[model samples]
Target: MTMAEKATDQAQRNTEIVLTAMRELFAEKDITALDRYWAEPYVQHSPQMASGLDTLRAVVPDLEGFSWEPKRIAAQGDLVFTHSIVHGWAPNPVVIVDIFRLDDGRIVEHWDVIQDLISAEATVDGNPMV
Candidate 1:
């Protein structure tokens, strides 16, 4: 495979790792597994909260059940984009878009936009328009 193809493959694998860890974290209502996927200075851009990994670790427990299904992924260079649906206590189905920047085969930064998937107008192309 070409270098770009290899990078894409690696990025896809990394995305899977992060997604699985996130799902496991929510299913167990714990952040232990999530720590392995997020960087120390991780940044989150969500409507509800914006913080680093440490803060997320502290707040995850307060959330009841959390699980997500990643639907699409695309990557180029060091960035990967993912569209998914998150299901949990606060909302039944929340559309979320996550962007991750990877460094040396590990995720170093993250940004996400989440919206409640309630009405038909709230969704577009099977994802939240954010």
Candidate 2:
């Protein structure tokens, strides 16, 4: 494959890794299991989560029923971003955009924005966020 093709393929793989880890972390709530997916000294930029895997491990719920339905994942180099909908953890379904930075196939830094899911009818553009 050409160099450009190789880069695209690698980016796709990175997107897959981020999506899988997110599913396991939020949907499965397997906090400790993240050791396989995250690098040491993971930095968190979300207002809610603090830095490090230890802090993340302490806050994640070890339960089922939660779900993260990702609409899209974009990746370039070591950065990956996913747009998704979350349910069962908040009072209402929420829309989230998560950004992750990876190193050697392990996620090292993270950021996210969470917003209340809006109704399709309420949109002026008449298009769904997803």
Candidate 3:
């Protein structure tokens, strides 16, 4: 395949990997998916979580009512980013952008920005925050 074709293929695969991992871990609440997709020394940049896959494995099960609905996803090179609406982790639903870096098909690093969802009335422009 051409270099451009290869890059596109890799990006698609990486996006799929992150999407599946997120669905299984948060929506389905299947912790074992971490073993399949997460690297041993997983680096987490989100302030709420610590580095390491063990930390994630330890926290997911107790997260009652947790759910994630991905609005969109994109990928470039080794990085995949997703915009999602999440519930049960905070007092209100949250909108989050999560970035994952993958190596050899397994996620090795992560960074995220999360904000509580606000109603359209709450926005100065009155635009819905989806």
Q: What lDDT score belongs to each candidate, Candidate 1 first?
A: 0.70, 0.84, 0.91
Candidate 3 residue lDDT tens string, 91-126: 889999889999999999999999999999999999
Q: Write the per-residue lDDT of candidate 2 for residues 1-130, one digit (tens) a residue.
A: 9989988988888888888888788777877668879988889999876888888777677434678898888898889998999886577888999899988889999999998888888889877877
lDDT of 3 at 73: 86
Q: Which model scores highest in lDDT?
A: 3
With candidate 3 superimposed using the best TM-score fit, by how many Å does residue 118's alpha carbon deviate from the native? 0.4
Model 1 ranges with Cα > 4 A deviation: 89-92, 119-130
| TM-scores for every predicted model | 0.73, 0.88, 0.95
Q: What's the number of clashes in each of the models?
A: 0, 0, 0
Clashing pairs in 1: none
